[model samples]
Target: MGFLEVEDLKVHFPIKGGIFNRTVDYIKAVDGVTFSVEQGKTYGLVGESGSGKTTTGRAVIGLNDITSGKVLFEGTDITSKKSKTKNVRKDIQMIFQDPYSSLNPRKRVIDIVAEPLRNYENLSKIEERKRIQELMEMVGLSPESILKYPHEFSGGQRQRIGVARAIALKPKLIIADEPVSALDVSVQAQVLNFMQDIQKELNLTYLFISHDLGIVKHMCDDIAIMYKGRYVEQGTKEDIFNNPQHIYTKRLIAAIPDINPRNRADQFKFRQEVQKEYEHSYDDYFDSEGLAYGLQPISDTHLVALPGKG
Candidate 1:
């Protein structure tokens, strides 16, 4: 079985309206989204804002309710029952986007990092303190800083604190919901590289949700593109980066900043061409309701939501 598999997952929020406030319509935050993560691999979920990439990650970790479908973790259906178990919760962790808000300003660093340990394990006081210290050091924070509050640290350090907290129980999977988007460019690189290093050391699988194509290219082993709550394309990093099949994916790739002065003219021309194709062929990829079609397999590792009858 895959390390983690989400099968036809959907998260719909009901829109209440009228005096009676009866069922009006649903906002399909995640519609039929399906993907899997292997042990020690990073899967990138990339899209523009409001594309439901963040919602997908939240649903995987049980933060958002699943309207339908299954989430399997190591062959067990976590969506239905296993998600409630202490072991399952311990195995799956999340690092939220906003470090400042995610970490409680009222609590000291030790309390924030040790919160997971207290929930899942029955470690002695000394052992818990030792564990939190080790986690701090692992994320490049000094052990002595454990007494400091969240606001005392820099933005990057606070984020690392979040990272330390996420990995406290040595989780098998970590849902990183735009983990670096809140940081500066240089800090983003530092955090991303630190995450990569820890993934190697701890054999952690990551569901990386982000809109930055450059960061996705740097960190992800596989990539999936989402639009309007539906998956448009999914494949290996090489496939998506080198030979993107979906128009949305192509546009995203073309938008990645190219620093080479020599390729300035070529890059601009390529983006213009992609934009033209996207504008002209938009209807070819989406239906009248502006939703993508169901994904169809093009290769063993590649799937695309091409418009037409299956």
Candidate 2:
């Protein structure tokens, strides 16, 4: 089994309407999503905002309630069951999208880094201090500044601090939700390289959630493209990028403002490819169980999800 598995996961929030608070429909934040993450690999979740990327990440971290479906860690289900999640959380950690908001301005950097260690394992105060300082250096922050607060650092440095705090406990899986979106272009690469280096050094599995296709192309081994709470397509990086089989996926790729912008006709062709993928399924195939997420054989290690209703 994969290190992490999300099976038919759904997170729907009730929409209020009418007088006396009638529950109307539900906003399908994450609807019937399914995927698996192998150990020491990066699985990129790509889509526009409101496509359920952040919600999926939060659900995986157990911060948000999963109304249905199963989130499994090493084959054990962790959906709404608190007891099944204890050990799983220790191995899994999260880096939030905003570095500025994620940190506690009141706490010292040292204590922030040691938070996980304090919660999971009862380490001696001295040992925790040593490990926390080491983690600061590991994430390119200076240990001398451990006593400083979150407001003392710049944007990039704050993010580095967040990264330090995330890996302090030596987690196996790190869910990085746009970890560099708040930084400048130059700073973004520095952070990305830092993340890649740590992944190699630590053998970490990352569920990288981002809308930036360019970053996704560089960082991900496998990619899943989401649209309106559903995965419109998914595949190996090569398959999804070079030969995207879904309309939503194709459009998303084209949406990446080309460095040397393509001509109108070439751009038109790209749009067509995207639209073709969005086309309805043939009579032979029926969408399964609202199977917005599935494995259509593009090749080994490559899969695409088609839009159709069973």
Candidate 3:
């Protein structure tokens, strides 16, 4: 079994309306998603906003309730609330998007990072201070600055503090939802590289969720392209980038900005061709409801949502 497994996970929110606020319909945020993350590897869930990438990560981390499906961590069924043991909670953690709002404005950096340690460990004041300092140093921040508030730091620095809090419990898996999307482009690389460094140092497994395919290509070992709450394609990084099968995947990849001036013309032409193909063959790729069909394996490591069966 993989280190982290989510099988057919679905998260639906009740859409209440009318006089009594009864459930008239359900908004299917995450519809039948399944994947696994191996130990010390990053699994990328890529999509635009409202495509359920964040919802999937939230469900796996227990922020959102699952409508159906199973979540197993290291072969333990932690799907239900009762089944999620204290050890299981300590094993999994999340680094949220928007560091500005994620860290409490009222709390000092020391308290922010020490919250998890306090919950999961019985350390004295000196021990907690030492551990928080070590984590601050690990994320390239000053141990002395632990007394300051979140507003005292830049955007990237706040994110580093968020990272420190995430690793405080020594989690085996981290669900990072758009970890660097809120930061400046120049600082994004620094945070990502530092994350990789710590991943190697700590042997961490990551469920990396984001809309940027460029970042996904840089960070992930396996990639799944999500659209309208379902997966359009999933494969190894090479397969998804070099051999994208789904039209939606093709469009997303083609939409990535090409920075090379020499290749701009060629890139534009390729994007135009992909767009043309997508417009003309849209019906061939999706169902009547405009959702991707269930995943079908094209190879041992590649799966795509296609129209027909073999």
Return the clash pairs for model 3, or none: none
The regions of model 1 sitting more than 4 angstroms off are 81-84
Candidate 1: how many backbone clashes? 0
**The 10-residue segment with the lowest total lDDT in model 1:** 80-89
Of 1 and 3, which scores higher on lDDT?
Answer: 3
Best by TM-score: 3
For each of the candidates, give the backbone clash count: 0, 1, 0
Which has the better lDDT: candidate 2, or candidate 3? 3
Model 2: CA > 4 A from native: 261-295, 307-310
Write the number of the candidate with greater TM-score, choosing between 1 and 3: 3
Residues 1-310 of candidate 2 have per-residue lDDT tens digits of 8799999899999999988788999999998898999999999999889999999999998988998999988887778757757887888899988989999989998888888888998999898888888888899888899999999998889999988988987899999999888889998998899999999999999999998999988999999988778877778898898997765566677766656555767877777665565465422222544435454666776667643335
What are the TM-scores, per candidate, against the unseen true structure?
A: 0.97, 0.89, 0.98
Sort the predicted structures by lDDT, highest score first: 3, 1, 2
lDDT of each: 0.92, 0.84, 0.94
